[model samples]
Target: MHERHTAKARRRRGQRLYLLIVLVLAGGLAWLQISRIHSAAGVVSGQQIAAPKEGFLAPEIQFTGLDGQPHALSEFKGHPIILNFWATWCPPCRGEMPALEAVYKAYAADGLLIIGVNQMEDSGKVSRFQEQFHLTFPIFLDKQGQAGATYRARGLPSSFFIDQKGFIRKIVVGGMNEPLIQGQVSALLGKE
Candidate 1:
């Protein structure tokens, strides 16, 4: 009788251990499924509002600059603004900064405002990157990525061209060559 009781207790313990393992595996699978679902949803939602129209007045959003001053998109009306959403960690974003800086230098006097909205980066890194690149334009910090969400930035190096009327005229995503970007900028500037 004593031996039978001991065997029964051991079997119950083993059963509990097995059940716990199964529960852990189930939880991990659920997490993976949820993540996949979010990723898919993001992709689909991105396709919906990817283009900018001539008469489209942009949504108002405020973000902190590298200097800690508040910068609002609405304040730069009557000029074409290139709002570039980028991060220090993104290689594509890094690749396009030089081209963007050059465009800014060339057309800044012609009323081109290049607003670099750095996403998910520490200020120190961004400051150092700005110094490294000799980037003269104001760098806005979107630490919480709220500005990215507001702009519907789906990937790194997403950019929007806001025209003189404060309307979004074009949207660019990923790493595009200088000519393409410049063309878009010029088209929005109405220089072409």
Candidate 2:
């Protein structure tokens, strides 16, 4: 009888251990999913800034072009705009330039304007980078980084998608490949 009782107790302990393990695993998985969701929702500077939702007017950006011409975001009011913030020294920004150039060429005839806002870089470096990449899109020099600050670009290779009505439709905060750039451009042009 004692042996039988000991066997039953052992079974109960084993079942309890199994339940504990399952609970721990489930709790861990839940935490991981929550973290992912939070990260995707935008956490910048240790604070959460709500993404500029669709239909919100984009902040004004004024800068001098590499061609010695003044430019303003409002000037591109009638067309879709891809406002990209980048620096010549940023690898990811360099990596994404080709894709930007391709998308610009593919859609420029359709009134797609791509503006590369160089973050506090000298005109010489910007010009060299543009030449090396064979980038034909307009390059704007953000000498004071005002445009970058206004756009709240926390990282290199941030892009804002603006529609014809001058409303910001989407914001991409990292490097983009051809497919991603094309997808965003298509959406901005209302093809998606």
Per-residue alpha-carbon lDDT of candidate 1 for residues 1-192, written as tens digits (9 for 90 to 100): 999999999999999999999999999999988777555643543432323433456667788878788778777878889899999989999998899988889888989998998987888999999999999987889988988888888898898888776667677889767898789888987789
What TM-score does candidate 1 get on C-alpha atoms? 0.70
The alpha-carbon lDDT assigned to residue 1 of candidate 1 equals 100
**Can you give the TM-score per candidate against the true fold?**
0.70, 0.71
**What lDDT would each prediction earn against the true structure?**
0.83, 0.85
Clashing pairs in 1: none
Best by TM-score: 2
| Candidate 1: C-alpha lDDT | 0.83
Model 1: residues with Cα > 4 Å off, grouped in runs: 1-55
